[model samples]
Target: MSNNSILLIDPNFDPANSANLSLLVKIGADTFSYVIIDQERKFVHAVYDEQECEDGYEKLKERLKNDTYLNLKYETVKIATHTQNVVYVPQELFNENEIALYTKFFADADSQNIYVQPSLQQNIYTVFSLPYSIEKIVNHNWQQSIKLEQNAGLLELAVQFDKETLIIDFTVGSFQFVYIKNNNIAFNQNYQFEDTEELTYFILLIVNQLNINMKQVAVNVCGIINDGDNKWSLLTQYFDKVEILTLVSDLDTTILDDMPAHYYTSLLALQTCG
Candidate 1:
């Protein structure tokens, strides 16, 4: 964790009771966030951290070794990671044997681990891949963890709520863009941006091609962008409906007091994965 990372927990939270809490984690090679929620869907503990991609794996190892809350036993564990190599197959058409054909999730087929992510609100199966090392670390740390791609959570929200026609999630060096039309994912991809110019090009290409109504688009921006940041300035200027995404309404978010609610909306939404 860095100086800017944030961790919060209810002072009265009982360590013995963690057996009933559900752990939801959103992770990437470089960034990680997780929440411990009770059966009532209340967030009791949360942590968000980021660093250079090279150090992410080390950070994960350190945190898991030293973080008491994370080491606690949980009734359920759900994890989500961002991957651009995704193939959406209908439930009926999904073939477990053929899933191995999805580009080895961008790795040598033998070195990659594939995951099939299912959604309650959508009929399609989100099949994606992650490095074998990443999956090994996660599964080794927490037994029986359900895995999902980040876009699965974003798409789930779009289908269930019929809102946020487009969502943009920012992280350390990249951002993911999801466009939902008619309650289905139209476009979802992650892009690396070295400067605002590169980001503007991608955003404009999508907006111009879709000819989206800036007024009614329901553009929600979440993750790392801050007020007046280059990404923030570009987005607020591009869409009239652009705004920081709010945390899900189903849980008590007062745990986030004095924190940026928008920064973790995507991580909190992984609750939908469970």
Candidate 2:
């Protein structure tokens, strides 16, 4: 194993980390996950979360007392998501400074790689680039041959247009709208909800508030597909061109195991790029 690699630990046993890469080992009360991305190359070196521990920590310690398994050492711990369960590995593994240096290595729509650091946190008081208060939603013309950025295991839905594209973030119960026109952002909206009904209601409310007719819009239902239930069946009743996305043509079909409802949407985004 490379010294510059780290592991992620999960205590909640949430399936969300299943798609994430890096060294994911389920050791009793914790799970480990990690991913190495080449932002410059638009590629990722990821590890699957299928690693297992041969012996329990307590058992390992007891075995070590008897000089059984040897050479076990870990250092440099970090925590992600919930409260205070840390992931530990070698200290020299993954320099934070090196990660920061590659943070700016991103590509533009023209496929030109540029060094730009993403905002670690959004500014609350900053105004939108253009002064149009997006109090309502806007629907532009739709196209089938549109291309979009692939979600690195993130659930994403996008509606492409000639002038702009509307991308929806549906990874969680809440919703976030990001609009890009002429390769520039036009508007953003965020909404929180408790259930799918509220989520659908919020979508309709946004459309009505923005004076956008449902007939002219296309909705993609993603992320929670194979729960042995149909969550998007209701969407067809509201929109004329609703689509349920699946994997791209190039991906292996075996990836369909543990298919989340939004997996189809992720596949659609990948298809756009293809």
Candidate 3:
């Protein structure tokens, strides 16, 4: 990891606990974050770093080579940028050949850079991907791995609660909005924002497009935000019930005493995908 990277390690972390370690690496456009969980599903150590695309991958490779805890039995690689596409296909009608058709939704079908991941949800398949750089780096490290739906972590949050839910996962230059109604995914989209006004505009645009009753739907937010930040205040103007996302009830979060739990919610929820 770079010298500027922010890292947090639980005081109780022990190398002997490697047998139960599970790592999650989330690569985004301008930043990357990772979380390590122990056998008992407790947060062991985590890191969040800001770097250019190529530099971030190089740092990750360096970390993998030197970080003792990363040599664990299980790891999950998640690409969290907007470079990919998400298409819902009926389970019975889906086929490997159709993967190319879905790729066309976001990119040229002939592009070699495209990769597809189909996650089954009852009767539908949520197909998503990792960009070529992300795919190359992750595959080079872990030959056998799973491609997580970009919204999988958010979906985990949505299902755990019984309400019309909207989750906004914020990062450096981008953010993702996920809406769940009646325990099913209604909409999921990512956007780039230059300021709070642009961000608020997009949020209201989605709200109007979805015909969501702002007063009734509960908005749960996560990722790099705080109580009195401009983004938080803007969101409050539209949502009366806006609140930080709740961590999964089972994990031990005592190690996160100094940081807002919402900031690492997505990283922690990634484990639920397993």
State which candidate has the highest TM-score: 1
lDDT of 2 by residue, 112-177 (tens): 221111111211111111001110100011111121112211222222333344445343344444
Model 2 C-alpha lDDT versus the unseen true structure: 0.32
* Ranked candidates, highest TM-score first: 1, 3, 2
**Against the hidden true structure, what lDDT does model 1 obtain?**
0.73
Task: Give candidate 3 misplaced runs (Cα > 4 Å).
Answer: 1-4, 16-19, 41-43, 47-82, 90-97, 108-124
Q: Over 4 Å off in model 2, which ranges?
A: 1-167, 178-186, 225-231, 246-274
Candidate 1 C-alpha lDDT tens digits along 55-107 = 44566677788788878899989878755556776666777788766555553
TM-scores of the candidates are: 0.85, 0.37, 0.81
- Native-vs-model 3 lDDT? 0.67
Tell me the TM-score of model 2.
0.37
| Per-residue lDDT of candidate 3, residues 89-180 (tens digit) | 65576777767677667542333444444332443456665556656767776666555655567666666666798899887556878887
Better of 1 and 3 by lDDT: 1
Model 1 spans > 4 angstroms off: 51-55, 90-97, 101-105, 111-113, 160-164, 208-216
Model 2 / residue 22 / CA error / Å: 8.4
